[model samples]
Target: MKNINKNRLFIASCLALITTAMTFAIRARLETVFGPEGIGLTLEQIGYAFAPAFFGFTIAMIIGGPLVDLLGIKKITWMAFLTHAVGIVLTLLADSMTSLFIATLFIGIGNGFVEAALNPMVASMYPEQKTKMLNRFHVWFPGGIVIGAILGWLIMDVLGLSWQVMVGALFIPLVIYGVLFFGQKIPVTERVQLGISNQKMFSSVLKPLFLFMVACMFLTAASELGTTQRIESLLKESVAKPLLVLAFINGIMALGRLFAGQVVHKLSPSGMLLYSAIFTFIGLWLLTVTSGGMTFVAAAVFAVGVTFFWPTMLGFVAEYLPETGALGLSIMGGAGMFSVSIVLPVMGNLMDNASAAEALRTMSILPAILIVAFFGLHMYMKKRQKTFEV
Candidate 1:
C-alpha cells in the first residue's frame, strides 16, 4: 500500500473497462449498419467479423498473463491504451468487413490486456477484499454499456449523427485513463509477494478443479456474452428497441454488481454461481416466449443471473486458489472469450436459417449446463467445508 496510488490505478482500470464495454454497445449498434439491409452482409458474416474481438482477447490474455509478472502491469496497461487508441481510429475508418475485423482485433487485444493487468492489480491492492473490490472494478463493464447504449440512442436515434462520431467518442475515456495511469507506480501481483514461483502457478491451474472451472467459464461466458452480443439480431423481431433492451440488461447488471458484496457474502462464490445458472436458465427461456415491454422484465432476470458471474469467477480463483496467480485468472478469462468467439458464428448461422427465438432457446442450453455443473461444485465445496470444520 505504501507509495502506491490505489485510487488512481483503480479509476484508470475502470476507464479501461469502460472503453471495452463501449465497444460492445457500439458494436451492437453497428450490426444494423453492416447487416443484410444495410451494407448487404449476412448475419453470419457479421458474426465472422466480430469473432476477432473475442479470439483476439483470448490471444492477448494468454500472452499477457505470464508476461504481467515479467514485463510489469504498467507496461500491459500502456499496451492497452495504445491498442485501444489504434482500434478506435481504425473502427472509425472501417466500412467493410475486412477493415471492421482488423479494427476489432486491436480492440479485443486491448480489452484482454486491460483485464489481464487490472484483475491481478485489483487483487494485489486489496488482497482481503478481492471479491468485493473486483466486483466494484467490474461494475464499469455494464455501466459503460449503459453509457454507450444511451449515447447510441441519443447520437444515432435522436440526433441522427453518423456512427463515426460515436466511434470518435471513445477517445475521451482512452485519454482519461491513459493520463491517470501515466507515471503511476504499480505494485507486484499478490502471487509474487507470496513468493509463488511461475512453475507452481502453472501447475496449480492444471489441477482438476481449476480445469473444471475453466470448462465452466466457457459455458458461463457464452451464456452471458454470446446472448448480449447478438441482442440486436436476437430481439429485432420481438422488440421495437433492441439497443434499449441491451441497455436495460446491462443497467440491471451494473446495479446488481454494485451490490455484489452482499450477495457474495450471503451465498459464497459457489452458491452465487449455482443460483446464477438457475436464474440465467429461467431468464433465457422467458426471453424466447416474451415480447415488447415484457422483454425488459425477462432481461432483468437474465442480468441478475450474469451480474456476479465474471467478477465472482475471477474472485474465486484469486481467493480460494491463490496459487494459480495471474496466469490462472488470464486462462479463465481467455477460455471464456474463446468460447464466445466460437459460438458467435454458430449463433449467427442459427439466426440466418432459424428464428431468433430458436437461437435463444439454443443459448439457454449453456446456462442449463452451468446449473448442473455448479450444483456439483456447490456440493463439493460444502463437503470440503465440513471436512475442514471437523
Candidate 2:
C-alpha cells in the first residue's frame, strides 16, 4: 500500500469507467437519431443494435475475467483502450442497423474489459473497504452519465450541433485515463495475494449463495439499466427532455453512491439491496403513472432505488464470497449485462406495439421480483451473521 500509488490507480479506473458510461448515455441519445425521425430504423431495430453492447459486455467479462489473472490488468486496460477507440470511430461511421450493432459490440467489449480489470483492482487496492470503495469507484458511472446526458442535451438538443461531436466527447476521458495509467505500478488481484489456487477460485463460484446472487444480478441490472438505456423511447411522449431526465436520474445516483459508505455501515449490503428493490418497485410504478413536470419526481425515486443496485451487488459478492475471486465478480456482472441484452429487445417491442406505460409496467416486474429475492437474501445474511458471531 505504501509503495503503490493506489489513489492514482483508483482515479484512472474511475476515468476509465466514466468513459465507459458516456457510451451508454450517448448510445441512448443515438436511439432518436436512428429512429423514426432521423435514419428511420424502428425501435425494435435500435434495440437489437444496442443488444450487442450488453452481450458483447457479457462475452468480454466472461473471457476477460480469467484473462485478468493471466494477462494482467495493464494488458486488459489497453485492450479496453483499443476497443473503445475502434468503437468510437465506428460509431461515427455507423449508418445502418448492422453498422451500429458492430460498433456497439466493440464498445460493449471495451466496457467489459474496463470492469473486468477495475472491479478486482479496486477491491485489491482497498481490501478493508471493498464495498465502500467499490461504491465510490462506481460513482463515476452515473457521474459520467450526468456528464454525457447533459452534453447530449446541450450539443444535440440545444446547440443543434452535430452528434459526431457528442460521440467524440468520449475521446477526452479516453485519452486522460490512458495518460493517468501510463507507467503506474499495478497490484495483483486479492486472490493472488491470498495465494488462492485457480482451481479453488473457480470452484468457489458454484456456491449456492454465489449462484443466487448471479440470478439476482439479472433482475437488478434489468431493472436499472434496461430502463435507463431506453429512456428516450420510454419517455418520448413526456414534456420534459428524456435525456435530461436521464441526466437527472444519474445525477442522484452519483451523489448517492458518493455517500454510500455511511449507508453501507448502517444497512449492510444485503439490507441495502432489499430496500433498493422496494424503492425501485415504487419508482417504476410511479414512472408509469406520472407525467409532465411530475416525471422528475418519479425519476428521483428511481435514482435512489437503483443507485446502490450495481455496486452493492458487486460489493456483496466481493465481500462475502471472497474465495470466488475475480471470476465470481465477472460472472455476476456478466449475468447482469446478458439479462439487459434479453430485456432490451423485449422492452422495445413492447414500446413499439404497446404504450410506454405498458412497457414500464412490464419492466417493473423485475424489481418486484428483486424485492422478494433480496428480502430472502437479507434474512439469510442476518442468520449467517448470528452464526458467525456465536
Candidate 3:
C-alpha cells in the first residue's frame, strides 16, 4: 500500500469501465442509426455486427485473465487504451457492415481487457471488501451508460448532430485513464500473493460450484445485457424515446449499484442474485405488455433487478473461490459476455421475424431458470454457512 496509489488506481478502473459503458450506450444508438431507417442494415445483421463486441470480450478475457497472472496488470491496461483509441477512430470512419463489425471487435476486446485488468486489481486492493468494493467500482458501468445515453440523446436526438460526434467522445476517457495508469504501480493479483500455482488455480475453477455459477452466468448476462443491448429495437414501437427509457433503466441501476453494500450485506451474494433474477423476470414480462410512460415504470423494475447481477456474480467468486484468483474472475466475466454474444443475434432474429414482445418473452425464460437455480444456490450456501458456524 505504501508505494501504490490506491485512489488513483481505483479512479482509473472506474474511468476504464466508464469508457466500456459508453461504448454500449453509443452502440445501442448505432443500431438505429445503421438500421432500416438509416444505413439500411437489418436488425438481425446489426446484431451480427455487434456480436463481436460480446464474443471479442469473451476472447480477450479468456486470454487476458491468465495473462494478467503471468504478466502484470499494467501491461493489459495499456493494451486497453491502445485498442480503445483504435476502435473509436474506426467507428468514426465506419460506413459499411464489415467496417462497423471490425470497429466493434476492437472496442469489444478493449472492453474485455479493461475488465480483465481491473477486476483482479480491485480484489487484490481490498481483499476484505471484495463485494462492496467491486460493486462500488462497477457503479460506473450504469453511471457511464446514463452519461453516454443522455449525451447521445442530446447530441443526436436533440442537437441533431452526427453520430460520429458521439463516437469521438470516447477518446476523452481513453486518454485520461492511460495517463493515470502510465507510471502508477499495480499490486500482484491475490492469487500471486498467496503463491498458488497456475495448475491449482485452473483446477479450482473446475469445481462443481464454480461450474454451476458459470452456467448461471450465461443466463444472467443474457437476461440483463442481451435485453438492454436491444432496448431500442425492443421498445421503439411503443415509446417515442426508447433511448430515454434505456437511460432511465440504467440511471436506476447506477443508483442501485452505488448503494449495493447494504443490500449485499443483508441478503448475501447468492440471495442478491436470487432477488435480481425474480425482479428481472417480472420486469421483462412487464416490458412485453406495457407501453408509454408505463414503460419507464417497467424499466425501473427491470433496472432494480439487474442492478447487482454483474458485480455480485464476480464478488461471489472472489469470496467463495478465493483460490481461483484472477483466472476465476475472468472466466465468470468471459462466460457472461460470451452468453450475450450468442443471445444478441437470437434477439435480433426474433425482432425481425416475430415481435419485440415475443423476443422479450423468450428472454424472461432465462431468469425463470435462474430463479430455480439461484434458489438452490442460496440453500446450498445457507447449509454450508451453518456447517462452518458449527
Candidate 4:
C-alpha cells in the first residue's frame, strides 16, 4: 500500500475517540434522567428506552458491514455524523420515554457506525501492528470515559447544568469528525485491500474458534458495560455519588487500556479473561457487602477487571477471525452492545423491587457465567489448535 496519510488518520482516530467518549457519557447517565427519581420512569421502562442504542448498533453493523464494502467508508462515516447529530438533538428534546428511546436508537446507530468505519480504518493504516495499534486505538473507550466523567462532574456537580447540556455536548465531536472526513479519500476495508474474496472472509468468520470468541465477546461486553452502566442505580445506597464512582471506574479503565499490549502479551487473552472474571466476581461481591469508601475501592477493582474485556474481545477477533474483515469487527461490536442493552433492563428491574445490594448479587450471576464460559472457550481453542497441526 502507498504511504498512508498519517496526519489524516490521526485526525480521524481522534474524532472517533472523542465521539465514543461522548456516546458513553450519555449512555452511562441515562438512568440519571430516566430513573425512578429523575423522570419517574420505572426501571423496566428505562431499559426499554435504552434498548434502542444497542439494537440500533446491532442493526447498523448487520446492515452496514456489507454496505461498507458496497457503499464505501466515506458514505458510512458521514452517515454516522448525521445520525449522531440528529440523535443527540432528539434526546435533548425528549421528555417522554418514547422520544428518548428513539433518540437513543439513533445515537447507538451512529456509535456503531463509528466502530464500523474507524476500526477498519485504523487496522488498514497499521497493518502489521493490528493488536498493539487496536489496543492503543481503543484507549479512547476508557479515555473518552475519563473525559466524559470529568465533564459530567463539572456540568452536573460543579455547575448544576441541565442534562440536556451534557447530551448536547456530543455535537461538538460529531461536527469535528464530519469536517475531518469532508475532503479526504477513504481506502477500502482491510479485507478488500488484501484482495481476499467474500467467501474466504465468511469462512474465516464461521470457524469454531471465531464463534467461540464472539461468545466471549458478548459476555465480556455484557459483564463489563452492563454492570458499569447500571452502577448509578445499583449503588445508590452504598455510595454518596454514583457518578463519581462511574468516573473513577472509567478513569482507571482508561489507564489500563492505554497500557494493555504489554499486559495482554504477558497474560494472553484467555489468561486475561480468567483473571478479569475473578476480579469482577469479587468486585461485585464486595459491592454487595461493603459501603462507604470501600465501595469506591471495589468499584475501581471492578473497573480494572473489565478494562481489558471489550478491547481484548475485539483484538482477539482481529487476530483469530481476520477473515470476517470489517464485517466481523462490526458484528462483534454490535453483539457486545446488544448484549449490554439486554442486561440494562434486567438490572433496572432488580433495582426497582430489591435493594441495590440484592441487585448487585443478581448481576454477580453474569461474571460467574463468564467464568464457566471462558473456561470452556479456553479448552475448546486448545483442542482446535491440535487439529490444525495434524
Q: RMSD to native for every prediction?
A: 0.7, 0.7, 0.7, 2.1
lDDT: the better of candidates 2 and 3: 2
Write the residue-wise lDDT of candidate 4 on 42-129 in tens digits.
8889888888878898888777887787788888888888888888889888898999899989988888888888888777777776
Model 4 residue 21 lDDT score: 68
Say which prediction, candidate 1 or candidate 4, comes out ahead on lDDT: 1
Q: In candidate 4, how many Å is residue 265 off?
A: 2.6
Residue 206 shift from truth in candidate 4, angstroms: 2.4
lDDT of 3 at 70: 90
Better of 3 and 4 by lDDT: 3
- Report the lDDT tens digits of candidate 2 across residue range 1-390: 567898899999999999999999999999999998999999999999999999999999999998888888889999999999999999999999999999999999999999999999999999999999999999999999999999999999889999999999999999999999999889988888899999999889888999999999999999999999999989978746999999999999999999999999899899999999999999999999988989999999999999999999999999999988888888988999999999999998998898899999999999999989988999999999999999
**Per-residue alpha-carbon lDDT of candidate 1 for residues 264-372, written as tens digits (9 for 90 to 100):** 7888899999999999999999999999889998999999899988998999889889999999999999999999999999999999999899999999999999999
Give the Å shift of residue 182 in candidate 3: 1.6
- Clashes by residue pair, model 4: none
**Position 144, candidate 2: lDDT:** 97
Separate clash counts for every candidate: 0, 0, 0, 0
Looking at model 4, which ten-residue stretch has the lowest summed lDDT? 1-10
Worst-scoring 10-residue span by lDDT in model 3: 170-179
Tell me the TM-score of each prediction against the true structure.
0.99, 0.99, 0.99, 0.93
Q: Candidate 3: give the clashing pairs.
A: none
Q: What ranges in model 4 sit over 4 Å off?
A: 379-390
Model 3 spans > 4 angstroms off: none
Per-residue CA lDDT of model 3 for 1-390, tens digit only, reads 679999999999999999999999999999989999999999999999999999989999999999999998999998889888888999999998999999999999999999998999999999999999999999999998988899999999899999999888888888888888988989999999999998999899999999999999999999989999989999998799898998899999999889988987799899999999999999999999999989999999999999999999999999999999989999999999999999999999999999999999999999999999999999999999999999
**How accurate locally, in lDDT, is each candidate?**
0.93, 0.94, 0.93, 0.79
